[model samples]
Target chain A: MIQVKDLKRTYVVGKVEVHALRGVSFEVEKGEFLAIMGPSGSGKSTLLHQLGLLDTPTSGEIRIAGVDVIGLSDHEKTIFRLNQLGYVFQEYAILPELTALENVYLPAMMRGERRVYYLKSGIDILETVGLGERLHHLPRELSGGEQQRVAVARALVNKPKILFADEPCANLDTESSRQILELFKKLNKDLEQTIVMVTHEEWHKEYMDRVIYLKDGLIEKM
Target chain B: MFEKFRVSLFLAYKYLTGGNKGITIFTIFILTLVFLQLVLVSAILGGATNRFNELMIDYQTGNVVIEPEEDTEYISDAHRLMSKINALPEVTGVSARIKGVGKIIYEDRSVGATVIGIDPLDENTVTKVNSAIVDGDFISKLDRGEIVLGREISGGYGALMESKSLGGVKVGDRVNLRIGSVDREFRVKGIYTTLFFLVDSSAYINKKDMEDILGVQDEAHEIAIKLNPGEDEEEFRKKLMGIGINEEIRVWREFAGIVELLTRTITQIGNILNLIGLLIAFVIIFIVIYINTINKRRQIGVQKAIGIGSNVIVASFVLQAIFYASFGMFLGFFAMQYLITPYTVTHPIQLPIGPVILSLSNTEALFRAALLFFATILASFIPAYKVAREDLLKLIWD
Candidate 1:
């Protein structure tokens, strides 16, 4: 369901150019739970960002569900992301002012679905993430684990074909992190949800169907 | 477009209601002050202009005046014309006056003045000069040699042009008036000051005495007429013309050349002050909204990331600014009409011209409100667009 070929990204900090991704190529099949693992500054998060269409790479090609996302206009890209892709940030980036239910339903609302349909879908997804009791709570009112669950519910509300998590549990404690990982594993096994997650922990590879390792901006192992 | 507007509105309402209450209220308060500043200068200038017109109507020309036809010295058979004018139902009062240029001599000083002869009883019905006596009683119609002098001619009661006056003439002091070949000694019964320098340079005496000096019987230089409230002066002039009264008739505004010039000068200054007030409002609102939007940079990025469209985010901020401006203008208009203006009516502001009240025309108020609304839209849109259009990763992370 996804394809990448020689995707490269670079950044200029002051006068020096640092290559984050160098000639990396990979692909994931449908219904697969994949984990991208690497040490710090090894292009793991950079690759996820490129595939998620959150940032454009300096050079390369990427296709998800057979659409050339890199060639789409900015507006078309936003619509594509809204309709087909979802992202969970490292910070559990739900809007602070919105209630959990509101946060989960926002993307569906932007997609122009009926209010009742979006509300029901948002509620069902929140319940699936074990956050049914925290539907009306704000981000600040929820614990770290509960807020992360809300982010997961938001990502799933649009029924995206591909879900991307960029170190989603970077700020969580050990128990909360385990709960999030178990929820992801259940989603992949029961619902056949395809997810690409980036992590540094070696134990997280146990829940993944396939694992890829990166070293110095290039694929080192698969 | 409608859907986008709906989203923008939702976000604006949520932010305004759920955001920091102190900042919202403070920004609204500042906008209210700016609106007031925008209109107060013009309102005060309007009040001064109104006051000027009022003085002319009250002390110089009663709503309408009838002068002699062109190339003629006087309106012939003035008494018959006065009676014909008084016969109309709209005419409240009419008075005929014989005017002559002369000099008034008191002690060793003499000053040029316009000598006017008025029927004291008829003059009282047309003008409020009778009520403006500051020193002594107004002259009675039967008092033949008694006269009334304005402070500009009498020279002591805070006269603006005191040096050009007759020095210090006192009530009951005898003053000599020289009109052409006619010179008469008269007792000053009263001194009045209208605070209008032009109107205060004239002296009044009994019409019978003026007729004898000017040697014209049953003729007048001009006839002043007062009408009931809401009477149309031009329509009345047409009615007089329809009656075959062929004479030069004019509304009081035609006699306001000098006052009109003064008001125009003040209005120019008022326009400059209004421009400065709008600029200050723009800078103030821009800074307040810029800081507020800058603080929400990460939130804006998240909204954009979740497919909220950059246009929607920017429109939300513009909507907030419009709400702020609308509320501020409404409160300012309310306070001016109900509280500030009424207070001035009870306790007028003492200006050098006279006691002045603020006059706020709805047209001017509405025009200024539109200008303020424009300023608010531009002030909020710039910052919101700047923040929303930035790089997405930088927005979410930095």
Candidate 2:
């Protein structure tokens, strides 16, 4: 479960005050698959980042699983992110120097998981994502869709409570996008994996349990 | 803590080996060249000065010298002092000499030179005068009207002034020596060269002959003493004083004050060279790691986003620097110890003072290597800290 009360974010750009999020508030229950839809510069990604604990809000409170995360120190926040949440960026943020298996197991390594268990769990997740054959391949060697799948596998390796994806299918073709959406649907339905995704595509509604639309930094429709 | 180190090491290894192989090798090569410069530059400088010191000890001044007391032209009871010094357990050899400044004449060519009178057999024991002979034979008791001239003296006053041979006289040529109204003609028995301008411009004669000619019987102007291996010259000088000898006693270092000063100056220069070498290494590593971290900014941001600590990322870059420095220094040490040092020993550089070889001790090598290692770590740390402290949001999105 996640809760946000009047979360606001502001940025200063060359002596100009830019309000990316204007007191937006929302909530999602456990096991829910939510998607935020908005036009360009509508604060969808900014809201997602704030909820995912990737950036601090200007003045607001955020609670995940009933714990207030606003006042956590930087180190405590990193540990919280490691143990409770995972992220899949829009650009398939897999490290280029690492193999698919290495990329998947990096968070596990950071969590101090033993080598044997980390390797086994990494392989299992990659296999579940239909990427067992490409475990040894680098990110550059894989196609965009495959790289996103690897990112998804990496996000799942630590068994975090929630997965945050910001435009996961932005760089994929229609067919590849459908496959990734179907994968997300299966993960949500079968494993009861909670996910919050940001997207501009309208047709992805089939997989999202609830969709919120935003316009100009505020909730316009739900 | 161990787990943190393990993770840092793993990431460092992956980044180092998974990158372009050519760049890795080239970076290591540059590090090797820098380490070599750090080592060889100081060693060469040290070698030249060390060679000068050895020459002074071996050819000019022995381990210790005993001079006549102040206001006395010659030491009284010289034979008694020589016998007592020779009997000391630490004494290896002792040679008493009579020194006098004399004017030399060679068929209209005249010059002033220091004439040192030595007991030929005992002199060879204290100094390598016998070994430095370049022409003819060393003096003997049976040869009375014989003298040995240094190369510069025998070559004439013009040669001595210009430090080049005028070719006026040769070995076996007859020359006249005048010391304080005493004139004597003698045949030059040999011409010796020590490659030292001062030593090569002086002459030598039999001690008994010198005392008789100068009318200073039963006296010596100086006594040179050579000690056995590992004997302390200062302790020996103190021992001579303890035994009630009234003459002034000085060690080789004291007698060769100018050479000692030059040696200290060279050592200071060597320290500057070391500092410059370290600075170069620091700048090189700083720029290299800075560029590398800049190129990997996005990946660093991603790692931070995924909950890898900033300290872990900094540790990885520091580890890479340590690897570069340690490996490069290892190669440099190998070359200096097994290749460069032995080769130079066998084929020394011919300097004006003597032959010079690379002179680096094991302790010195290790100290310099450690210095370079820490310098490189410091170099890498600054940029790594800067990159690690950047905001993850800005790093990823910017």
Candidate 3:
């Protein structure tokens, strides 16, 4: 579960205040499949980053699983990110040197898991993303769609409480986008994996149980 | 935690062996030079000191020579004075001698040579005079009438042939042994070389012949004594200072002033060599480790962003420096042992330097090397800490 109240994030660009998130509020319960939609400069990704503990909100309170991440120390924040949150960036943020299997098990290894446990779990996560046989393949070797799939497997390998995917389908072809949407829908239903995804397409709303639209840093429920 | 260190070491090994091998190899090169520089300095200092001592062997070692109590050109009771000095526990040997200034005459020429009269058997133990003969022989067949020579004096007098005696006088030809205002004919028997300049052609006769020439039936000119090495020559000199004879005390090391200067000069040269070596090591290690840390900027950023501490990264760099310095040390060591040392055996070369600083023997050497290593590691910090403290999320975006 996650909760954000009246979040406001500002940036100073040459003595000018840029409000990326202004007075935004949101909540997602356990096992909820939420899709966040917004145009450019809409603060949708910024909000997701705050929720994933990747960045802290400048003036707001964020609680994940009833613990206030804002009051936590730097080390505590790192532990929370490692154990509870996972990220899948739009650009396929995978280390180029590591193969898909190594990338998937990175979070688990960061959590201090036994190598044997991570080895088997990495295989299972790849299989869940339909990349069972491409474990050793490098990201550069995989297509745009397959690389995104590896990112998804990496996010889920740690069995995080919530998976945050910002623009997961932004770079894919239409058919590849649909395949990714269907894959998320199936994962949400079968594994009860809570996902907070960001997308720009309107018809892709069917992939999630609820949709939250953001305009100019303000949330508009539809 | 142990796994992390193990992984770091594995990566380090690969880095040293693989694409990043230059830094590691350079470290070995630096250490080797330092080790060899130290060993070379030691060998030079040791050899130089020994050479200086050997030169002193043929020259002077008179400590408390006793002459006549009254003003006299020669001591009349030389045998009795020698017995008195030789009886002391501190005295090891004694020589009775007549210091007669004379002209050595050759065919149509004359040269100044000190005519020193000695009891041949007694003088040998005090001076080890026989050992210095490089040509001809010692004053054997003394009763047959012979004279020894010095290498330099033999050249100066135009002396020729091994068997020819003083002034090319034949075996039976007589030469003058002039003392003060008298001359005696001495048959030429054999020629020999010695450490002193005049010994080459100067005649040696039985000591009684010298007493007959000086016209002193009871004594000789001076009695030279050989004291033990540990006996302080100066202290002995001072002990005999006010005894008020025409005699004086002399140390062998004093007469060989040039040798002492040479020993000091060699030590100074050794010091200079060590400083030069240390400077070279510093410059080489600094550039190499700096480049290595710079190249790893991205990797360092990743580690720090992943919650790794700054201390851990610094520890890794320190480990790298130690690996490099040790490699260089042994390399330099082996170079000295197997290469430079053996070559010096045949041809001794002196390195112009001061006394070696021996930094390795003290912590200053490590302090210097470590300071250079830390400087190299710290040189990386500008880039490492810059990336380390940056926003992790932003880095992921990049």
Candidate 4:
């Protein structure tokens, strides 16, 4: 579950203030697969970043699972993110020097998990993402779709309560994108995995449990 | 803390082993050259200083010298004192010298010289000057009027101060020596050179001739002593004092003020070179690490976004730098100690002072290694810290 109140973000470019998110408010229930859709510069990704604790909002109050994430220190926020939140970026930002298994188990390693437990968990999650045979492959060695799958597996390895996907299939082919959307649909339906994704594609709405449309830094319709 | 260290080390190991091989080898090779530059200057300076000290002891002051006591012109009963000193088993040689600053004139050319009176056999045991004869032979005890002229005093034979010496005097040539009020003619028996400018400006003659001219029989200005191998000069001085010998005994080092000044100047220059070498090493490491960190900006942001701490990222770079510096130092030290230094020992470099070999002390090697270690840490930290502390958004996207 998430709660955002009066969320606002403004960027200054050479003495001009650009309002990215202005007075936006929203909430998502547990086990819900939500989507934030908007045209360019509509504060869609900005709102997701605020909710994910990846960026500090100019003026906002964000509570994730009843904890005030906006008020936490940077260090505490990092620990919070590690324990309760996961991220899937557009470029499949897995470390190139690390194999799929190493990248997948990074968060659990940071959590100080036992070696055996983290290794097994990493392998199980990679297998779940259909990357069991590619566990030892590096990001450069994997195809675009395979790399995205590896990123997805890494995000779920820590068993975060909420998963945030910011254009996770933006760089993939049409088929790869379909596969990722289907995987998200299956996860939301079967395992009740809570996900908040930002997308520009209209057909993506069919897979989401709910969709919110933002325009000019505000929630135009939900 | 232990967990953080483990993660940091793991990252460093992975990066070094799996990253660009060319960059890694380049860094290590550059550091190796830097380390070698730092230690080589010190080794050469040490070798020169050692050679200077060796020249002083071998050709001039024979390890220990006993001069006349204050308020006395010469040590009385010099032969008796020589016998007493020679009785000690550690005393390998004892030669009493009657010293005088006099002028030598040959064929209208005159030059100041230190004229020393010595018994050829006794002097031979105390110093290697007799064996350094370049032409003719050393003076014999029975040859009263014959003298041994240093190349500097006799001139020619590649003398450094040729213009300031007696013009071109050769063996069997006659030269007039003037001391206080005594003037006499002596044949130049041989020309010797110690390659040390100060010691090579002196002349040696039979002790009987000097005793006759100065009218002080059985008395001498100083008694030079040479000890057996591995003997300590300070301990030997104490031993002489323990034997009731009331004279001004001093080690060779006390008489080496000029050599000390020379070596100290060289050491200061060596220290400056070493500082420059370390600075170059630091700048080189800093630039390389900075470029690498800049290239990894996106990866750094991704790690941070995925919950890897900033300290871990910075520490991993530092560990990598330390590994590079350690390998460089080990290679440099091995090459210097086993290859370079030993090569010089077998085939000494002919320096102006003498045949010099590179001398690297363990303490100096360790001190340079520690300095380079600290430099490596600082060089790696600045760039890594700067990159790691940047905002996640900028690092990831900008």
Tens-place lDDT digits, model 4, residues B1-398 = 87788889988988998899998999999899988998998899889888988888889889999998999889999999999999999988999999877898898899888899999899988899988899999887788998899989999988899989886898989999999889999999999998888888999999999998888899999999999989999999999999898889999999899988988898899889989989998998899889989999999998888888899999999999999999999999999999999999999989877799999999999999999999999999999999999998889999
List the global CA lDDT of all models.
0.90, 0.86, 0.66, 0.91
The DockQ ranking, best first, is 4, 2, 1, 3
i-RMSD of all predictions: 1.3, 0.8, 4.0, 0.7
In model 1, where do residues sit more than 4 Å from their true spots? Answer: none
Model 3 gets an lDDT of 0.66
Badly placed stretches (over 4 Å) of model 2 are B64-93, B101-114, B135-137, B151-188, B226-256
Model 2's interface RMSD: 0.8
The alpha-carbon deviation from the true structure for residue B156 of candidate 4, after best TM-score superposition, in angstroms, is 2.9
Kindly report the docking quality category of candidate 4. medium
Instruction: Give a tens-digit lDDT track for model 3, residues A12-115.
Output: 88999999999888889888999999898898988888887767788988888999988898768777776787777787767565688977886676566788
Q: What DockQ results for candidate 4?
A: 0.78
Best by lDDT: 4
Where in model 4 is the C-alpha error above 4 Å?
A185-192
| Docking quality (DockQ) for each candidate | 0.59, 0.72, 0.15, 0.78
- lDDT tens digits, residues A1-222, model 4? 999899999989999999999998889999999999999989988898888888999998899999999999999988888889999998989888999999999889888998999999999999888999998998999999999989888888999989899998899998999989998888777788999999999988999989999999999999
Please tell me the TM-score of chain A for candidate 4: 0.98
Per-residue alpha-carbon lDDT of candidate 1 for residues A147-194, written as tens digits (9 for 90 to 100): 999998898899899889999889999899999999999988888889
| Model 3, span B157-267: residue lDDT tens | 334433333334444445555566886666544444443332344545666666677766656666767777678767766655644334644556656676667767866
Q: How do all the candidates rank in terms of lDDT, highest first? A: 4, 1, 2, 3
